[model samples]
Target: MDTRERYAAYAERIAGVSPSYAAWARSLDDGVVSVLDEVPESKRQPELLFAVARRLGADPADPGALRALVQEARPALLGALTSATVQANDPRRLAPVVPLFAALAARVGRPLGLVDAGAAAGLCSIPDRVTLDYVVGARSEVVRMHTASVEPGLHLVAEASGAVPTPAAEPIEVRARVALDPNPIDLAGPGAFDRLVEAVPPEATDRTALMREAARATLAAPPVRIRGTLPGDLDRALEALPDDVVPVVLTTGTLVYVPGADRQRFVDRVRERGVHWIALERTGILSGVAATLPDDVDPADPDAFATASLDGVALAVSDPFGVCVRWLADPNL
Candidate 1:
């Protein structure tokens, strides 16, 4: 597609996911998006546009404010766009995957060494620190776990289809926490912190608050996050885990940036080590995992969201950012 067409499509996607950003992107003339054509495709996300606008003190909800920035703050916008890679990192997405993590941990029946692959800022590495409230099953036979506690201080809610997977009788013990990122954000650094704030859509206050709370909990005693590229650095990161701990490699929406061959390679390598793999990635991105999905799944739709798998077994289908979850029947977990 041409630059104009590409941006138009992006606008439609942002509209479905983030209406505020959709308005700002649509307000920009084709020439402006074309000017950013030189930017790598991976960096040309709707959040990038709003991140720059937020940094320039423009209110994305106010068209006039955003338009003014587009017209007058061209240099600043361009600089922010070019300076850093987009780190679509948010703890909100981890909410839907928490139950699956718990279920997988129970299946293994042991304390897990949690390792987050492509862990930006490593906020997701601390899923056990947040409390979860789950409501599952259909309306007539609904099941509610009002305070399905993980840790404390933060509570998140999620809706699930079918029966809820029972969390392990004993909370999954996270003996060690390790994160791998090409350039992990330093929660202590002001600039890195601001960039993380800007990464989410400007209108998502709930998500913003969640990030702040997660960051506070994580920084209280931050886990060791290795800064290095994937595939190439996968071995070294795995080696850093404690020998006695049962390694559980977790990757959520991280494989999309990797080449197909490398994704399979990474999976094979993890399996070779006899560790369990928990993948919450875009639908159809990985081969065997997609084949295990139910036939009715539509992998093409952007809103089709993701398929969550544990050790190549499909368990749940969730909204892309994990706002909702529909647990599968007897996932063999």
Candidate 2:
């Protein structure tokens, strides 16, 4: 897709999620998109452009903010665009998968060895330590996985489907946590936590607050951060873990960053290692899993959002950030 089509599609993608972003994306005139052309196609994504502008002090919801930023801070914007990518490391992203993690943890009956393939700031790495709140049709309940060791942690609230309500399970133990990313956000470094918050749509004030809370919890016990990207770095990350853990690799919106073939390779490697793989990615990205999606879901439509799969089985389709989850198959319990 050209710059015009790309932004137009982005407008539709986030329309329901962020009205401000939707409006701003659709309002991008030729000149503004041309400024986006200055960066490579991958970096030209609406999220990157808008986020970079916001980081540079542009009002996020303002329709023509990018144009103004380009006029005032072109050099700084371009310099930032040279390296910055959208960081969807929101710890709240774990909400939808909280149930899936519970089922997996119960089945394994061992301490977890977590390897997050694209763990931006390692925020979502503490899956077992966080508290999960599931909103069913008419009732809301909390399912917590935290042991006595970790401090009060992330409280993830997600509306769930009727088929799979919150599970009552034993607390999951995290023996070792490792993260692999080409550029992992150093949450403890100067201004590092703010960088992660920049990706949250400016209209989302609630998420911003939750992010600050999550950051504090993550800083308390950060992951053993490694430097690498998906599929290629899975083994190296696994090798860093202790031998007693039930290894699990997590890929949340990370597969889209790699090529099509690498996606399959990553799945293959996970199976070969016999470690459980939990994927929350775009629908069609995984051919086998996509085929298993209910007929009503369409991989081509961004509105289908994302699919959450466990070990190649289609588990549920949910909001990209896991705010709303409709269980397709039982949590594999």
Best by lDDT: 2
Candidate 1 residue-wise lDDT, 1-333, digit = tens: 665565566677667657777777677675467547766655566666667667778886786665577578777777777765556577766666776667666677777788888887877777666566666655534343323335333566776665467654545467788789887888888777666777687667777888888888678647678987667788788888888888888888888767778888988887787888887898888888888888877875654578888888777778777767766654433
* Candidate 1 segments exceeding 4 Å error: 1-17, 56-59, 62-83, 137-153, 300-303, 331-333
Estimate the overall C-alpha local distance difference test score of candidate 2.
0.79
RMSD of 2: 2.6
Indicate the worst ten consecutive residues by lDDT in candidate 1: 140-149
TM-score of candidate 2 relative to the true fold = 0.89
> How close is every model to the real structure, measured as TM-score?
0.85, 0.89
**Model 2, residue 264: what's the lDDT?**
83
Record all residue pairs in model 1 with backbone atoms less than 3 Å apart, i.e. clashing. none
Give lDDT: candidate 2, residue 330: 77
